[model samples]
Target: MTSLNVTTTTLYMARTISLCFLVALMEGLDLQASGIAAQGMAAAFQLDKLHMGWVFSAGIFGLLPGAFLGGLLADRIGRKRVLMASVALFGLFSLVTAMAWDFNSLMIARCLTGVGLGAALPNLIALTSEVAGLRLRGTAVSLMYCGVPLGAALAASIGIAELAGGGWQVVFYVGGVVPLLIVPLLGLYLPESAQFRNARESAPTGVVRGLFREGAALPTLMIWVSYFFTLMVVYILINWLPSLLVGQGFSGRQASWVMLALQFGAAFGTLSLGWVMDRLPAWALSALIYVGILGSLIALGLASRWESMLAAGFVAGFFATGGQCVLYVLAPHFYRPTIRATGVGSAVAIGRLGAMSGPLVAGKMLALGTGTTGVMMASAPGIVIAALAMFYLSVRRNGAQID
Candidate 1:
């Protein structure tokens, strides 16, 4: 590339990544806001563990269709258009969430909010990866995706502030308003993916089929499995960890701090590991992370002190949450530009099933008398499964040097 070309491309990539950061930041904040507010929500609605699980599941349930259909629509329409719409959808529903007066109302609002979020993520990953180009792609995409953990961390900061007088509605209100403000700016500044614009073929149906085609089959299947398992453990922590900590005798502020620690670790891990992923054997890198994941889960279960649990939560976030971020980083390479969003979307759509089911499963197990330690120990297998799936994909199919 010529010097001028390099300069222009550099500017373009930075601009795109900046927008992705904002969008991802908003998404991270909104998604975790409910969790940060979970205790208050349960109290306000007189909800038990089972009921809270349902509320979490309800929002995740909406994510399923949003991911699948949003990807398809983004392919048919345009990434910029679809992404702008996705933000609008979620922002509107978040305001509705803040307005919710009862359990059912909250559930419905959250579900709709999830739909917008689910659609936005795959596109953000796909677009960021494509725009970053081949060199530094993994690291760039991973860095952009850091908005999620940072956003979650921001929510935890709010919890630490203890500002709402134990009320949770203000979080949603802020979440909703920020996006609404950004919508116009996104239109003005966020360009569509150059790759998507160049290759906007009308092949939405074929794209789904492309995932199952000969060369793509095993990698696609393995990626889906990895995403499902990785996301399962992630959502479980996001939905239940605070409440579980409370049940274990920690104050709400303490639980929030622990959650913040986790997100801080995840944010650090996502950025740090991306550089490693760019240079290391993909499987070896994943295995290294999963070992930490597995070890942390064990530590978390065994720890008796709050400080120890906090430390374990950070380690778990480093591997588990950061591991999931890598999956997003790796996904676009598995398909052509036309179907990249679809492929990522399908993975997330299936993974949403795992995310939705996690809380419900935990709730059922807890209701049936499973202790928090037992519940966490059981979750360890999910990280194991995710590692195995990633190993299979990385070594068997994805190549030592991921494209």
Candidate 2:
């Protein structure tokens, strides 16, 4: 009987982990497909580069409100239900986006999609962490995050391949359809976070405030800083790398390939970071990752030739993506279970502001001819600030009790 019980428990955990990964995959596809379709979208809408950026930013605006509401809903209703509903909503909007007749329609659809995407992430992160044991939590979270790079790469490949035959609309169609297919699977497989349920039952008054008011404030702030910096770096890479390479004299096809290399490197980096996180100090690991990123960025900026640029792109992806993954992994740990969703949601939403700003600022840099060296140097400060914040948070973690 004991053997059977252990087997059942193990199987259940495996199922939980798998479902979490599936959620990440679906969300990644939903979130990143548009960026891959950006050039085609600009051409279709007769938008200049700056105007094209608005379509992307509009989506993030929707995400802000959606994330807040979703966090509340997760605590009030249930994480599993919210997760499934958000995925469905995102998928539906994606389909609408594919059919958009003009830029305004596309912006509206993207905003709606953003709302769903924003809501989905916190619940998913909270639920995944709840099921995972402390010993393996980082691994479980990172496994789910591996979907991010995969989804991004999938979008890029589909976009490039169908540009001639199907155009940008097909990219949105695939993004919409794929998540819709995953919705039923998620509903069937995903379980509510047990911790969320328990917290809802026993949480004290003003639970959300406790994230900052209680001793948790220090770690929470650290998470915010790390999340913001990591996201900024990531968006800069994802939104600008292909164009950056092309401007450096690489062919369009070669630049596209470089982008893919970054995504692939990110996937592996997430897995490797997850493996090392438990064994090493969190801040130390994060700092090391940033150091690697800083070096890669410098190399990328100074590389006189294509071979070096490609190599630097791969390394940049490894560090940038992995660094962000760690922030997500650490978020839940920074707060008590009662406010876990809120904590994660706030960090993600705030971090997204930085994400939204990255490409815009980079565009400004291009306009000013800031050059790769200046742009790359600018990113280094963000990393250093985030690392210092993480170090402080680690100190606080030592004194606090995490529920």
List model 2 lDDT by residue over 1-403, tens digit each. Answer: 9999889767766787787677677677666666667767878889865676677677777777777678767877888888888888888999999899998898899889989988988887777777775666788788888888877777667756764577778767887887789888877776677777777878767767877785677777778787788788787777666667767788656666776777787888888887887678756785788898899889878887777777887898888888778778777777777778888888888888877777777777877888767777789889888878766755555455355
lDDT of 2 at 329: 78
Collision pairs in model 1: none
Evaluate residue 191 in candidate 1 and report its C-alpha lDDT on the 0 to 100 scale. 83
- Can you tell me which runs of candidate 2 are displaced by over 4 Å? 398-403
TM-score of 2: 0.93
lDDT of 1 by residue, 1-403 (tens): 6999989988988988999899898898887887888887888889988998899888899889999888878777878888888999999999998789998899999999999999998888877888887777787788798999998898888877754474687778878988888888889998888888777765546778988885888888888888887888888888888888888888888899899999999898888777787678866887898898878877866777899989988998898888888788777777778888898899999999989988899888888888687877787777788888887766653442333
Report the number of backbone clashes for model 1. Answer: 0
Candidate 2 minimal-lDDT segment of 10 residues: 394-403
Best by TM-score: 1
